[model samples]
Target: MPSVNPPRGMRDLLPADKARRERVLATIRERYRAHGFDEIETPVMEDYVRLHAGIGGDNEKLSFSVLKRGLDAEAIAAAADDPARLADLGLRYDLTVPLARFYASHRAELPTVFRSIQIAPVWRAERPQKGRYRQFVQCDIDIIGDPSARAEAELLAATLDAVDALGLEGAVVRINDRRLLDWMLGHFGFSADERPGVLITIDKLDKIGVDGVVAELRERGVTPTAVDAFDAFLHRPQTLELRAFGEGSIRKALPEDAPDDVVADLVALGDAVGRARGIPAPYFTLPVQFDPFLVRGMGYYTGTIFELAHPSVDYSLGGGGRYDGMIGRFLGQDVPAVGFSIGFERIVDLLDAEADAAAEAIVLVHDRDLPPADLVSLKAALVAQGTRVRLEQRTKNLKALLERAAADGYTSFATVTAGQTAADLEVKPLS
Candidate 1:
């Protein structure tokens, strides 16, 4: 027999779960709209070549490709040496790629600086585990064609507000700059060719402490001199303080020789976000920190990088960064782009599902002997008055049926007689 369950890593949300998700999505949409970000959508599939493009970083390997239509056994066998040739398109692994294509296609119709909100499902082929799935939704907000720190500021402010609207408390954003990472690696003598691998190892700093990182770098056979320098810097003794984002704190977190320009840019971003949020001191208002080693895993990230953190979870809630060079690959002209994505599948589990109090929801328990016409009339009358009414035939397990109705979000239930009109019905709260 075929399995009586949804495909692995996919799910079928029942009515109650679906309704709760919709409520959360609605809240997100309203908050983003209020920030002047327009909602947009793109096709779930894109050309296989586009998915394979170097800009996707490691996510390209996980994309689910679709075989070319009408390909027979012989044709498929011929392409065995080059499997990518067998597929013409693939599911999008993230919204950023599709948004880049969309912007390139509709540049003339959009504003010079476009703020877009994309809330949709993206697919990846993966060995799913707790809180991770092969198919899940991503909530992204991106700004295109703006090259100033203000773009980053607006994104940070809007994202924090949306998280607040969802009632996910104590969320903080950890900010960094890709340029700073490169500079730091270079400062420590890591060659240009070795920076990527070195950054990957440093990204594990949170997972593995300083000693583990140094040991791993040595095992990877990186330059002995460079590894020694980096290891020494890591072991340097210093007081760790819980400071917010600012020039002083940022400088303290980095080497004394860290470039002044990048530090200035990050400070300006922090200040702008603070003012936008109407906090007297920007860093004090929100929990933005400067982590010189925060290497976000995307190769296309050109400058600023950030990850969303919460005290309740060991993993990030979501993250994104500046991919200024990505849109240029499609449009043939440089357009600065940056985005932040909320891990919907992860954060949704963190919220407490609360019944919507404003809805007038009811269940009608009608006798089996009642005429169908009478039941229909009663339901239509209640519905016309803007009440959500569900008709349930009275059952021998009447108590069980009412209990189920209450759990399904019905506020009250009423017994309907054949002759009773909507006004004659008496409602009792479900308990």
Candidate 2:
């Protein structure tokens, strides 16, 4: 017999687990909607050509392509050298790509500055491991057609609020700008042609440390003078703090000659976010931090990038950034955009079991002799009273049945006899 298990990287949630996950998702939905983001959805598949578009960065390589139907042996053999030719569509690896396509498809109907909420599963052909999967849900919010720092600020504020609503406080957002990264590389004598490869190496700073990055750059035969200069800077002793977001803090965290305009924009971002959270200016106490080396891996990020961090976990809880140029690839015109995605699987893993349902929820444990229609009627009466009711036939293991009901989120239970009416039922809270 075939093994009874979900696919290698997929999962099967039991009733209790599903209920718990739904509760968390409900909270996230309510919070995002409260912040004025309207939920939207797109198909799970997109054209293979679109999925392979250069904007996806490394994620495009991991997309699960769907093979075209009705391919003959000859056709498959002809395309063996270029496997991608065998497929015409692929599952989306992230919400942002689908959102870009969505905006391009429905631009005229949306607001000039559209804020969208996308809570849906995305698939990638990832090697599954702890906290990583081939399929997972992403909670994403994006603002389209807004070029100002306010766009980025709104994204940060809303995302932080959602995280707070989920009862995961003390999460800090680390901010950076791709433009600053580019300029810093140039200032360190790296050419535009060499910057992409160098950024890939620099992105490994946290994983490999300063020496590892230097060693890799050297091995790659990057500019010798630039490597030495960067190495000296990396080894330079400097006091760094996890300070509140502010102009002084931002500049202090960067190299001495960091661009003034970018610094000013970042300061404005902090201020705007602060204002949104009702924190007055000149007093900076938001949970935002500036990390000059915070490079989000996606190549589509055109400006500000951020990652959600907590002191409790070495890995990021979530991240996103300004991808002002992505939509233009589909729409034929530039649309300023920024978004944040909460890593739902990671967040869910950190959450405690959901509390039992309130008193309005109850299970009707009917005697075996009770008619099915009568049992359903008893449940219907309770349900009509705005209660959640489930009818279960009395089992030999009474204790186990009640325990299962409680675990499934029922707060109370009532014993039902052959001719008992709704009023005759005595509901008692589950222990």
List the candidate 1 regions with Cα displacement exceeding 4 Å. 355-358
Residue range 70-135, candidate 1, lDDT tens digits: 999999999988868899999999999999999999999999999999999999888889998999
What TM value does model 2 have?
0.95
**lDDT of each residue in 66-163, candidate 2, tens digit only:** 98899999999999888578999999999999999999999999999999999999998899999899999999999998999988988898888888
How many angstroms is residue 254 displaced in model 1 relative to the true structure, after the best TM-score fit? 0.6
The lDDT, on a scale of 0 to 1, for candidate 1 is 0.90
TM-score of each: 0.96, 0.95
What's the lDDT for residue 120 in model 2?
A: 96
Q: Model-by-model lDDT, in order? A: 0.90, 0.88
- TM-score, candidate 1, is 0.96
